[model samples]
Target: MSSQTLNKIPLISLVGPPNSGKTTLFNYLSGKKFKTVNYPGSTVEYSISKILSKHAVNADILDSPGIISLIPSSPDEQLSVNTLYSHPKFGKPDIVAVTVDVSQLSRHLYLVKQLLESNFKVVVVLTMTDVLYKKGFDISENKLSSILNCKVVRVNGKTGKGIDSLLTVLKESLNEIEKDSAASLIKADKHHKTKLLESYSEIEKIEKEVLFETDQKSTNGKIDIQKINESIVVLNSAPKFLKADETSLKIDKFILHKFWGLIIFFLIMALTFTSIFWLAAPLMDLVNDGFSFLSENAFTLLGEGLIADLIANGLISGLGSVLVFLPQILILFLILGLLEDSGYLARGAMLIDKPLSKIGLNGKSFVPLLSGFACAIPAMMATRTITNKRERFLTIFIIPLMSCSARLPVYALLIAFLIPQETPWIGGLLLAAIYVFSITSSIIIAAIVNKFSNRLVKEKDNTSFILELPAYRMPKPMRVIQETIKNGKQYVVKAGPVILFLSLLIWILTTFPNYDPVVPVSPDVSPEQTEILKSNERMSTSYAAYLGKFIEPVMAPLGLDWRVGVSLIATFAAREVFVSSMALIFKITEEGDDMQNSILNSMREAKIGDSDQKLFTTATTAGLIVFFVFALQCLSTVAIAKKETGSWRIPVLQVVVFTALAYVFAFVTVNGLRAFGVN
Candidate 1:
């Protein structure tokens, strides 16, 4: 068949087993950069890319979930099936690109056989062909193509070898659109009928002619399997290898050695929180200052009314709120990435299994729970890794309680306001205490929920923590850079646009219909009296005023006035937006035209209530701290829950439960402090 020009092609779905370089090919074809996690099920969902052919036709290419077999008992396998049979959006694919690892042809061919049976126009894409010669294996591509009744294109997704030829084959196949007759010859039935028997016989003939046997074991493959087996065996051993490896100074010794491991874990956690607080502070201030400068300059250059205020308040402050925390987010991910790539995270999971077991969570729950700290959505998605349904659900349920980095801005702002920074250790202690509180509360809640729920716990004496600690090779520079770039891009792509819009919206709220009420400047009038009237006027007519009033009574017991309440409400959109909200409000309320100094001065003098009391009193600040500490105050988390659970009921319940607890706790803390005369 003559090749059709690339510019006029249809969709091609790339399917393969885990880690078979399917993603690499997708990246090459579509130019879409996807992060590759060091696990089998990295590509949980499908992603599409457009491959521009030399002739100008752009081909729609899809990279799908990794599946070991069509007959799947796991969620990942089921997801693959859904992708194949049901095109929820665009209907069925026009073509299928089946990737097979050349070295692991025997296992890889099983999936190819299944895909061929599905009746899609199959073009076999042989990936990792270099591994074949290295591993002393051989496959006759021409012979295999004849036997399977499909064109075989040898391509290396990694090295880009023979990619153009493969693309040409795809073009040729499109022109013909010939469905292989061999497809209808295989069925999923247990017993072989005439069609199935014929398909098997054909496959056997192809295997005999095309494949040459190899005696050499794959250096990486054997090591990986051996490590997995040893780790699993060690986990279930009678005496346990918990002490360490043969070095007498075992790696797991301090990492998972019960008492020492627990201590180190706590210390690592404490240091993580402390580092977030200290490192993020200076960067946050710089961002705030930078935004303030820009807002003031805009107001000065663009004049004093709506547009100026919008640029100053809405655009500058709102966007600044989200941007200020990027440093912290980067740092958090850096540490996490290192831990993950170094292969210590799984070991950490094993270390915590005994403690998790006490809460009706199995060892598998550790992966999800630890993942929750980064992002509850991914954490919830990770529940699929748990074999036990009860454990999976429990992990998802409790994941939101962990303080994801989104909540960091809210916590930092409130803590800095309420707690005295003069006492560094004291402030540090309080900050660390909050994380401890979060952990304690999550476990207790999980335990209570477990007791009430009737989810059956399947008991099996056979259990293991089998994981491959890939050789401690120096972390690949290109791989790390690639991942960081990929993750950073996703962050911007997924969360950036929403934040940009929200920032502009917030600026508009504070700046529009500017009310500049004149205060009498008589020498006889006291400064306090003048300040009081001006503050009242600002509060009555400002956008924050209207919002704060709506939630005033609900949070009255916590000593929050309309301003703080308004800030809290704004943050419900995204918790890290709190700082920007505060900055915006201050920009609107500033007496002078300068937004930066205006906000700083406003925050500095912010007091409690009427009667000469401050608006940002110690009690209210403490209350806000406690509230953020326990609140499930992130939309992203909720969205993630919905995605993971495949339902809204669980996420809704989480919102209600976490918010109620946060309010109650804050109210008690505030009132208790008042009663004790701490103010």
Candidate 2:
């Protein structure tokens, strides 16, 4: 917003401790789908949107990152602290909403107390009140408000229990807090840093008076709560000895068990990947046939020209290759969103924290690393949660090694050449092995980098891995669906156009300088054979072929010809483009439903340069698979890495190193497999 715009409307800044349901309340108030994963550091950056609500107020809401104290330790915290101090560009907020999880009120209110003492209008927004009984406590919101000298409201994010009341109070408070254009947010005297541990006593003393014991039937034989939002009463009447009421604690026991947790984590992943194939297969076929029908109609209508070929092969065919994977993308995001909201995502991180730390990585790296499997761009963004600069950079460097969904199309196409589609389970197993290998290789690389980093960087990065685990809750249906659709739209709107442009570029290069079918009539050659000769002659002399042959020398060691070599270069624009490039290169214009199968068969029958040897032997196919798994191909991922790290040097070096290593690995694989008599 401009300075004039900021001067007229009021700004309300939402600040709270991590995982305190601050973003959820922002979602309910603003009606935007900013992701709310059930862990700390989910909101690495702040979000701003016009207040979309029923209250008759013209204002903007700035959702800042969670901060424990006014003093900051990490980059993510510093960014939020910058806005709290009212950066000149963002302007000052009229009132600050400090969200606190009632279950962990004693720990969360430290920030609220600090904001109050800093001479800012503070409203204590209470979330997760449903889990009060689970935590063996109940809180009086009115008492806490009076004690803290601030307004308090209890709201349930899932149910929208008291959202209206919260908004109404915020509008009133906006007027009461006098407007200020002061450059500095904190007008009090300058101070020294007192660690969060020092404030524990004062925070607990205030908590004990307002928060009552939930284990007892009645606190001193009297039970009553003030009428703020009517959510202060005890939720569960059961007498419980455990910390969390019952179900969550029991569920946590097995999922968090040392031995069982590993099994459960792997089982969950196995089920997730199985569902991606079994569930999305039919949807993929539907999309494929739909595009095929469109292409056929377009071919008939346009009727044999460059426009027709561009529409049928370049546009429809190329888009179909990538869009066929949309179902799998949506399913992947849906399952991930469910995992995040159900709180199992955080536990999975905790369960594997020890093993990750053994490799000089933090548990905080788990979320970002898991996100890397979807797409490296967002995965690198998720690394903001890592507090230490050294660790965060290490996490970003290895993220590209994780096989993202963009590689799925490439993997699926090549695996068909190795394993028959008849025994699909074997192909599935092979696919699973690729994912496992990618993760294992990444861990090994991280270990080596960590060792070298420790020796090079003299200053010790002693930042501890601190995370607040959210209690297990049922994943909300609407939230999961919304997140899935949002991500699906993002992939289509952002990556779709790039894929189309590159596909068209490949088509133009392959189709130009047409070779006229002026072959001399031979008695032995049939009409079909003559037509095939004409098509092959035209393709061999095309621009793409010349480019492919130029790179053929480099690819010769892997037993690959110009056709396969060209596709390896094309996929770097975006990994899914490999299938489209191969489709266009092989002239598989009619992709009815077996587009991939057609490509696979053509690749099987393909011959090496002037030789009878098959191009796609087992050794060559395995080499290509390894090359794709380890290569840093996507430009978007590289751009994000630079933006996140604020250095072009790192991303440029990352691309060079991974690409070179991939070539060496592929070279080793092909020769080693050939030595084993596999071909």
Candidate 3:
């Protein structure tokens, strides 16, 4: 914590639009990389990185959220604004580097102008210069700098051009930066702080002196999307029917076209989901196996004691649970990025708008709910975009019901263990059933909540949805590589510390009482089996076991014993935790320990029904599956909901409702399946 002992890092903020190559530049600047988290209010977060500059400056270069305007509407935009205006507790950024794309210069200039007016001593990093070069546009750098009254460094973050110059400029600017006079001209009004609009006269005067063009074609012939802006004003003021009619007419030909558009929409989502499952499977297997191996080695090296148990059971198993899901997490983010960058995501929202409206939720709900597949934390965070209190609350309330990526591991583990690969249809059907149940139940719950809650009653005025689709550019290889690393690494850094501690705690709980007092045994047995037996009993004596016992009575009718009960609780932390927790309880100690054999052996050996029958009948497994599918099993989600809603009420409601429904459903499923002799 001591600054004197710490590295004196010079922080630099990189700001830009989506796909502006700002992140690319940050990756090059700092050896570190970042992943996209949806802007704070949205489910997706952008990636960022930091590295030591060649100037011997420890540069913490931040890849900021994309912003379209200074007047913030999205969480990303607001975050960018906040980062710029506020000083971090450590210190203020030494330099602000605003990177802009040449193709989208007009839109990109909005942020640049605002930064200039904010009195921040800024260095302009002009990225995507290669695109400008290819397009035959030429401008004198000196002239451009004079026009803007600031130093402009034209650089390609990709090819490393002008990077050195930009760095030198940054170092110099950090020494004697002065506040620009233009800062006084723009008002800090939320409604309209169009810096470009306010500075147009000065911009025009400067342009005449500095601007030059080569064989570049005039951009005026390109479609002017400004009309869509005017349409939003009219739509916002119009009645619901008129607004609906206008929007439906605008999109009907394409969205609901008899030809390819609808087909394409469906294909995109289908492909995305399929890709997530396919790409992550092998990596997930590796994570699971690797963690198991690490745990065994640690336990073997450390010997039989509290720290060993902590390392093995608490740290290794718990961390393994979190780590196993990283691949899926990365795949989900990558797909989301592709969708967003390709411009298909907004269209998907529009495509589902009409249907979602019929369900009493807005089309915007689709994005958040679909995002739930990645992590419900961000799904709940996304409710800010909902605008309506009732709709927002409704979305937040039902989001946990969706099968989040955490749940995917649980489902995968369970289905693979119980259902055969040859009968994949059965497993697929179960997965699909859970999804269907979630969507249907969400709609029903939203309708019921809407009846009692006072929803925003204003007619939709903002109805026309003509989004600017970025050209179908192949997702840049460098961008994808940077993104994959950022998200993948954070999974370890952000979640790793917590899981490590949890693992230590679990180890302590499961490895105490070296000798078993409950069931007396002869002293002739070998040490290893004796240790395993004692460890097993100690597990029963652990605090986690007591917790399971406390919840067991409530869950008993649903067919779960204390072991299963403990796992269900662990899952609330993260669903994948259930696997490692179960592995710990059963005292299995090897990576790639045949999960199917382990589960079957443990369950078959478990006593029930007057010492003859096995405890884990098919009905019981079915009940467990049903419970996981229906239950709200993520703490991160509830935390995020609390953050987003500015209340504990909705997340509390979600926890209670989902828990109750899961119990009831499991109870019925176990009893009914048994009664029908299906088990």
Residue by residue across 619-675, what tens digits does model 1's lDDT show? 767777778867887787788877766778678888898899889998998898889
If both were scored by TM-score, which would come out higher, candidate 2 or candidate 3? Answer: 2
User: What TM-score, over all chains together, does every model reach?
Assistant: 0.76, 0.88, 0.77
Off by over 4 Å in 2: 1-7, 33-41, 87-89, 133-138, 177-184, 187-200, 212-247, 455-459, 513-534, 590-593
What TM-score number comes out for model 2?
0.88
Clash pairs detected, candidate 2: none
* Ten-residue region with minimum lDDT total, candidate 3: 238-247
Candidate 1 stretches greater than 4 Å from native: 1-8, 33-41, 54-58, 74-76, 102-105, 126-157, 178-286, 331-371, 377-389, 418-432, 455-483, 493-514, 518-536, 586-604, 673-677
Worst 10 residues of 2 by lDDT: 233-242
* Per-residue lDDT of model 2, residues 469-496, tens digit only: 6777788888778767867777777788
Identify the candidate with maximal lDDT.
2
